[model samples]
Target: MTLKDRIQEALKGALKRRQSVEVSTLRLLLSEIRYAEIAQQKPADDSKVLDVITKEAKRRRESIDAFRKGNRGDLVAQEEAELAVLMSYLPKQASREEVVTAARQAIEAVGAKGQADKGKVMAQLMPQLKGKADGKEVSDVVSELLATR
Candidate 1:
């Protein structure tokens, strides 16, 4: 099934299972998808929907960090639960080794030979890694790889 379809199925399953937390998170995700569709005046494809979901997940992670820093353990826990639900729809994250390998390949593909080529390397890598790995992590790896050359 497509990611969108999978999300809808999960929403229904959550409802049937009386999973309040999951249901709420799914509803929020669907609402975000719908809003994006409306705003863009087009239905979102699976990738677009995944982008929205990933952004929401990232927001949740940032909020969790902020809450923790502020000593709001309850809020942090809540965000963590929501993040877990959001993450269920995403593909498996790329591991550090995978990211490093990919970044090195991207640098080579783009002929990025020095620090000055950071932009070229990143431009090549971001599209390959988007939604599969965090941008910061990918950039860090790319920087490290480029620095060595």
Candidate 2:
């Protein structure tokens, strides 16, 4: 089944199990998917739905970070729970080694030298890493590679 259908199915199961975090996270994700469809003026396919889910997961991560910084442990835990739920709908994440290897290749392909070529390398790398790796992790690897160069 498509990712969107899978998410809907999971939502129903969450509701039946009375898993509030899963239920609420799924609801929010579905809403975001719908909004993206509307904004794009077209129905969302599986890729588009995954994009929406990914965006929601990123937001949860950001919220968790911000809450932790503010010393709101309760909110951090809640956002982390939501992030875990959202991540279930995404493709398997790339391993750190895989991301680093790809970053190396991308930097070389773009002739990236030092920090100056950061954007150029990113432009070449992100599409390859999209849906496979986290952006921040890939960026960190890229920066580290350049710093060593």
Candidate 3:
């Protein structure tokens, strides 16, 4: 099944299992997906749906961090729960080694030989690593690689 379909199925499963937290998170995700579809005026493919999921996951992560910083343990826990739910839809994250390898390959592919080629390297790398690796991680790896040249 597609990611969207899987999410819908999980929502139904959550409802049937009386999983309130999961149900709420899934519903919010569905609403976000619908909003994106309506805003774009086109049906979202699996890749587009994954993009929405990734965006939602990022928002939850930020909320978790903010809540922790504010000493709101309850809110932090809630956000963490929501983040866990959202993360179920994402593929397993790439390992640090994998990201480094991919970034090196991307730099080579783009002929990015020095720090000045950061943008060129990043543009080529981001799409390849999207959803699979964190942006900051990828950026750090790319920067490290570029700095050595």
Candidate 4:
């Protein structure tokens, strides 16, 4: 099944199970996916839907951080629950070692030598890591490796 189809199935299952939180989370994800489709002037493919899902997941993570900083434990828990639901649809995340290994290859391919080449390395690297690795983490690993040179 496509990612969208899987989400629809999950939404139906959530409704049947009377899991209100999951139903709502799935609804929100569907809405985001629709918006993304509209923005692209066509229906999103699985990877595009995954991108929308990933973006929503990232936003939820940021909100959880902000809520924690503001001492809004209640909001934090809600966001965390929502994030968990969203993540159920995404592919498993890449490990740090995998990201570092990819970054090393990217640096070599781009001939990136130091901090000034950060942008160059990232541009060449992100596509390889997209949806699997966090951009900031990849950048950090690339920067650290370059620093030692």
Using lDDT, rank the candidates from best to worst: 3, 1, 4, 2
Model 4: colliding residue pairs: none
lDDT of 4 by residue, 59-104 (tens): 9999999999999999999999999998888878899999888888
**How would you encode candidate 1's per-residue C-alpha lDDT over 56-144 as one tens digit per residue?**
99999899989989999999988999999998788899999999999888887889888899999888888888888888888888888
Worst lDDT 10-window in candidate 4:
128-137
Residue-wise lDDT of candidate 3 within 5-28, one digit each (tens)? 888999999999999999999999
TM-score for all models, in order of appearance: 0.91, 0.94, 0.93, 0.94
Q: Which 10 successive residues of model 1 have the least lDDT summed?
A: 121-130
- Give candidate 2's TM-score: 0.94
Better of 3 and 4 by TM-score: 4
- Candidate 2 per-residue lDDT over residues 36-143, each given as its tens digit: 989999989987887787778888888988998899999998999998888777889999999999999998899987999999999999998788887999999999
Clashes of 2: 0
Off by over 4 Å in 4: none
Per-candidate total of colliding backbone pairs? 0, 0, 0, 0
For model 1, the superposed segments whose C-alpha errors exceed 4 Å read none
- Candidate 4: Cα lDDT at 8: 93
Candidate 3 clash pair list:
none
